[model samples]
Target: MASPRPFSRYEFLIAWRYLRARRAEGGVSVMTWISLIGITLGVMALIATLAVRAGFRADFVDTILGANPHSTVSYAPSQVYNELTEETYFSPGTIQDYDALAARIAAIPGVTRADPAVRGKVMATQNGQRGLGDVYGVSAEAMAALPGVVDPERASGDIADYDRGIAIGIGLARTLGVGVGDRIQLVSPDGAQTAVGTTPRIESYEVVYIFSAGRWDIDEARIYMPLAAAQSFFNREGVADEIEVFVRDPERVDDWTPQLLSAAGERGQVWTWRDAAGSFLAALDMEDDVMFVILAILVLIASMNITSGLIMLVKNKGRDIGILRTMGLTEGAVLRVFFLCGAFTGVIGTAAGVVLGVALSLNVDHVMAALNALTGGNAWQPEVRGIYALHGELRAWDIFRAVALSLGLAFVVTIFPARRAARMNPVEALRYE
Candidate 1:
């Protein structure tokens, strides 16, 4: 084992002095400036890219949670029956039991509310235009309990009237040329047969309110009506398709899902939004990972510039290095001196980059706005789904990761040139000068 040397303040001072003298030398090469600019740009790109990814991830999660219930319970495929003619679907049957189950689920820790829901795909038509939409049948109280649905103007007494009253998305209303007070026809795939064979059961509904969820898929493909009306329309009187549960903390939804399933008494399956919306979330994660890797390559390339700059410094100061060695400075001390110089260059460049990057990331929206204005409002909007506009969220961990990676790269870049400077023979260096 090597003995530990006493710390020397003078050694550090010597290192700093050598770095300052090199920096002040006349005719400093353009390569030095290029190195600094490279680092700055690399850091800026990394920060901006990560910020955008973080923003999109956050916005996507919020949009999904906002438009759908937190968790859902349904019968698993081939496990429990879902046929409209099942005994569970008759009057005075399992549909009435949902109220008791909802109460039981509500009593579970972290569970905020639970409601029965009926879901189906149906074709909606107004005038001559027809579009496919997801139909949800929910009780008036359940609709009120939902976060974004009820408002003063939109609320009409009780949700029971919602049996004949329906809420449609703004985009769908526009596409179909329908508005509040307009009647729309609904055709359910699972409607009861009238006589001889299959019959198209048709019902007209009055549009009561229009909502815009900012998500194109949801806003253009959903309609809400009372649960009983939907059950009657489908001829499934007693059973709901699923039970929707809202939780106090959405982050703990996975934890609560199993508990609710266990409480569902063996006839139902539980599904969290993480499961229902898995593909979208997975795509967002993959995008973030790929973007980060690409941006990190920029920083890696910048670190190479630091390495080249240090090599140039070593070449320019050969005679000075010879003099310092002749003055009894050890090779280790000489190495430390140039290493400090190179490392300090990295530190400064990386620090400046971090500051600039953070500023840009924090104000990305403003930057986008400025660009839009500069282009006379002709700038193309970012192609983002499920949100109103692009956003940037600066996470503390992301900033920390970027800084740490940059500093580490800078340190690694200093090593090779620092080693070469340490190994130079004083006699040969002086004779060459």
Candidate 2:
């Protein structure tokens, strides 16, 4: 507040000279450039990796919730898991009137819609091909709410009216070598009990539509048919296995449980989308955290180069420090000079990394596509069992965190060397010169 120009200009000028000086002047050394580059790469890697992880988590959650409902109003059994099969138990003790239950749920606040459905695993055979898939019986209203239907027109009408038609995912359709209008045989594991023994219940269904649900698991193994057909085929007339409910805010699904449960009545129990897929989501988050910790070590290693370079710089500038001190430069000013030099590297490196990381993250999909084209193969394809594609999302907060971490380390490492340079004895330092 006293003088606007009270800050020392000499320190910064000297620091700038040191940063730009060539090897001949014993100012900027090879180690300085190496340190800068190392920090840049480390920051870039952190941003890119974190961005990809964030994108994947978001995509995974969206795909999972999109293909399925946010919450399901089902007859709660003793236990519940993600996988659904024909042999999976449906609690007979709960309300069998799915229509009434669904209506009740739909009337709840924060509830968007509800649709009754029957789900089970079945063996599908078409032509000479055979595949195992999960089949769902849903009303037209319910099917319309599902995600990733390439041709909604085909699925918009009352699916409950079709007694001989079925909708299948694109992957399942491909595997069975069937298309729209093609006939496929579905064999349920829950067989009929005759005098001889239990025999598999088989039925032929004509494929009326094909859909891509974005999720590999769903796309590869889900089929939809009329609710009445499913109920009849499964020998559970006048009852549905579950009622899927959509909410206004899927993220806060847990908050709406009490209302949904109350509407579902005492015999009914509810399962949110998170309940079915929470474990998988948790595993992804854990993997991302581990990757972050591992990548942070690389940044730490790069910071070491900054420390080593600063130490060397101080040693090389010992004679200069002695001369400057004798010329009335304060110890604090001497400390400032070296600190600025180190900070220059850290700041520039962080800036460059942020730019590079953002550009790379935004264009990663295009870059991978180009690489695949060049290689004539899908080199960048996701090989995980349930993952269908690679996704990327860049959060500014993540970049901020990475930048702060890198700069903090760089700043901390600079202090020791700067202090050593400041504490130098003028007489002893000049003796060698």
Candidate 3:
């Protein structure tokens, strides 16, 4: 016979022929299909899981930082270092020129808006139910801008319309058994001293509006009123506890934080929302990493099927391997033939998995909504809502990483069996069959 055709072309053709052969023709076996299915399922799970986690984090973070300022500029007494315990005391002695300070911060390139606010704890009691909550003093104009925090559209009365009118969270209203036109008694934790000793400042505020920020923590434990009203009520006027700054890109708060802090000078300290929520966000990141590793193990387990299937293929194709070797098929070409068998399964499985996973991730919200409807429950929403609501978002990097991990593992697992086939002695392989 004339010289055998180039082994390169023949190697691929033979591998494809073997892969496509029916069981009757001693072709593609059940184990091959098992490996393909296993890889597809593994990759799909990994991609979808990671995408959901990423989406949940993005949605939750955005809801929080969007409703709140990206950073804050505060000037408190040096002795009050602990925010959790020490009350924010902005006495006239500690007060700074808020207008000038805000103007300076607003002048920053990335800074979009700056507003002064006073935050303090107050007790709310209505309809025999009582609870402690945080009260924020903000401008009516600023209140109109953040609907999640205080929606102007939903309010029947302006925060400045009434001296003691306030916007309350919807959850708080429910808990207090009150409504938009109801009155709630507020007792400031720190109030004026009296002959009876240091008594709490007590006042009544009409609930002009109710806001639902999709977070139970904020909705049930926070309220907002005009800065002027808060100043008069808290007995601290011509001053604010802190100046809140909003930047164009909240995600890049780090880039603008230092500059804003510098403008505030030594009298003020800067705090980004990220810094405030660092521990919670860090826990989320750690959870994502752990999930990735755990899901990656699923792909690794699936790849074992590729290894087993390839070994079985080599055994079944022993006689064919011997004949090919006798016909001048180089050992490397033999190795490549078996390698291609496993690689094709991996490639096809990974591609299918990626498509399915991405599709699921993109539409997961709708899917969840449907499931919840069917189940007659609010399964899609959080049981213990905090600073944000539940939502889904698919990131490109998540898919890329999932696909890379799956394919890389699939390709690596084929090496051992391919080498075994290449090292087989032609005489022994042929003698058995």
Candidate 4:
């Protein structure tokens, strides 16, 4: 006896024949075109939305990490050591046991580097321009370990002296209208009166190195000086405002915080970037959630097209269903054939959408550039900085989720139509003119 034809091949041919017949009908029914368009629009919207969210999260994280240390250890009440002012010339609080604390923290599994830092708020003035910026006094070696703290070639010579050198952010420098060899006045909050009763506590330093951390916050208001200078300015001797710790992985911030606190002893509290920038981070997360829900509606509306298209197919194929049932084909097989046809439409539409979405995500910058040219002005400037345009990195998980959702929605839309086709009475369908 001849072997029965493979079920897979038969199913494939049946699905293809139906698909081709629909296409050849010259002007396919409006419902069919609508369904295809719906799937295409839904898939494209999902992929694009996910890509933008991923990009925004990445860019925001980079900006935050660049501006602040991964984790910091400071005295709980007030980390600022206020006793060792330049006038008092008194010894300030020291680590008490610096070497021991360092050793204990370094032994922790994920600790990369731990260094002392002097933090103070100071008013910087260049010519008539003035701004309040953080003055971070760090050891030369410690400066090297901190992220985004590098001396640029143009200003290296200014900082060569070390004693009178100060590094200012590029944006800050621009606003102040100062550069290498320019004099800038630095005023500390603490001032003391002389024996005659006149307050005298102002100092001037030459603008040395200009650093750019690629973040508006850092570039707009950050200054670095030698630990000793900061110590003298803040009157904190042998003591530091905080101990900055670098970790191997930022995601493990909470894991390392407790370890740092233990090592810092009872006098200090450890704070992560997330803790310091809690509100900002929370806002970012909220933004992501809102965007996801809003964009998902676009996909949801597009899926309706799939439902309408499948209903139309069921009506168009009524006669085919009757013939197949009379030929001894089971209701289940008839149902499966139409289900496969709907799924095929979803698959093709989703594939095309993925390609289009990925291409758009990757070239978002170029697209913005063209728009800017056409508009003769900067448009689509959602980035943290106005200097550059926004671009999103496509994520694999996002793509997978998008395609799965599209196909799943297609399957759901096909069910009722497939079932109706299966339930058609062969005699009645055949009797109809």
Over the stretch 1-433, how does candidate 4's per-residue lDDT look in tens digits?
4533434567767876776654545233565566677778777777877787677667767666654678887765534445566343333334645546766777888888777788888888877999888898887767665556563542344445555688888878888898877888888757664686645357788776787765666777788889888877777766777777778888768888877887787776788988876787688678767876765666666666656666666677778888888887877887788778777777888888898889888887787788988987556543344223467789898899888778777788778877887888988888874
Candidates 1 and 2 compared by TM-score, better number: 2
Measured with C-alpha atoms, the lDDT of residue 273 in candidate 4 is 84
For model 2, residues 84-129, the per-residue Cα lDDT tens digits are 5636554454347778888888898888988888888899998889
Which predicted model would earn the best TM-score?
2
Angstrom error at residue 385, model 2 = 4.2
- Please estimate how well model 3 matches the true structure, expressed as its whole-model Cα lDDT: 0.80
Each model's C-alpha lDDT?
0.76, 0.81, 0.80, 0.73
Measured by TM-score, how close is model 3 to the native structure? 0.88
| Stretch of 10 with least lDDT, candidate 1 | 87-96
- Report residue 80 deviation for candidate 3 (angstroms): 13
For lDDT, the strongest prediction is 2
Quote model 1's TM-score. 0.85
Off by over 4 Å in 3: 1-10, 20-28, 78-94, 150-164, 370-389
